[model samples]
Target: MFQDEARFGRMVRIRRCWAPKPARPMVGNGYEREFLYVYGAVSSLQGQFDWMITHIMNTTHMSEFLAQVSSAHRRDFIVMVVDGASSHKAHDLVVPENMRLLRLPPYSPELNPQEHVWDELREKEFPNRVFNDLESVRRQLEDGLPRLAANRASIRSLTAWPWIVSINLNAH
Candidate 1:
């Protein structure tokens, strides 16, 4: 599984949207700095996704997310590909017995399939929208993530790079 963390917040990301005829479309923009972190992991071959929304990003929360994923897939030994975040490498970080972390090279977010999952979330759940409060943003994520996770075919189509598919096939 490829894993990453992303920040979603009250800050609006303006994107182009359709407006009828020549009518100008208006989008609300907010400068609020509040945010929450989402930890996500995706198995490209199986179209399996796991995620957790958290108030903060740190070793403790990362360990908890790892434990959650580990417990979910108890029958499989998972090698999770992750970036070189400090939390991922913390000396005290707890790694579950059934999983191991493989660090992607620095400055290589494009190599991770999980980044595409985040892009899908932003485009579908957050496009041209402004949230009034942090809780609103949280609620949006709380609602959107499960919907995204349930669509295994969509997740596979979005994330199954040729290299990933080839590797998985070769492994078997």
Candidate 2:
């Protein structure tokens, strides 16, 4: 929802571009997939105390991380969580034991600040992104995370989402 590209794609396909003819051209291998999700946080303007957790990368991971983060931050002042994953409720993977998960509702990405952080991170830092393989991309993301941690504001924004920063506190 950060840039609203994916949602726009969905909307266009559903509305503007309806199917009619059986004749069509195949495009590429159809292996390209957009794995989107980020651990982000929202500060109370001044930015002192922060809520953090392990970010959910994919749907499989999102449910579990969501469950874990929800539990750890249940009592915190920063208990609000904003997310737009259908799997968060439909899939048990997004929900952990003893944790309550909340959804950002449909077509509501603006509520999630983490989306903005991820957009900035991807476009600004990972410009002209090219990777040899999935492992290469994974390694780059891992490397960027630690660096992201250094920025209190960014980290706070990044983990403000439900399933990222708080999960770490649970592990300890």
Question: Which prediction has the highest lDDT against the true structure?
Answer: 1
Residue-by-residue lDDT tens digits, candidate 1, 1-172: 9999999999999988888998998888899999999999999988999999999999999999999999999999899999999999999999999898999999999999999999999999999889999999999999999999999999999999999888742234
Clashes of each: 0, 22
Candidate 2, which ten residues in sequence have the lowest lDDT sum? Answer: 6-15
Question: For candidate 2, lDDT tens digit of each residue in 67-172?
Answer: 4455545654333454554544454454444444455667777666655555555654454454444455556556665565457775455445664434543322
List the pairs of residues colliding in candidate 1: none
Off by over 4 Å in 1: 168-172
TM per candidate: 0.96, 0.51
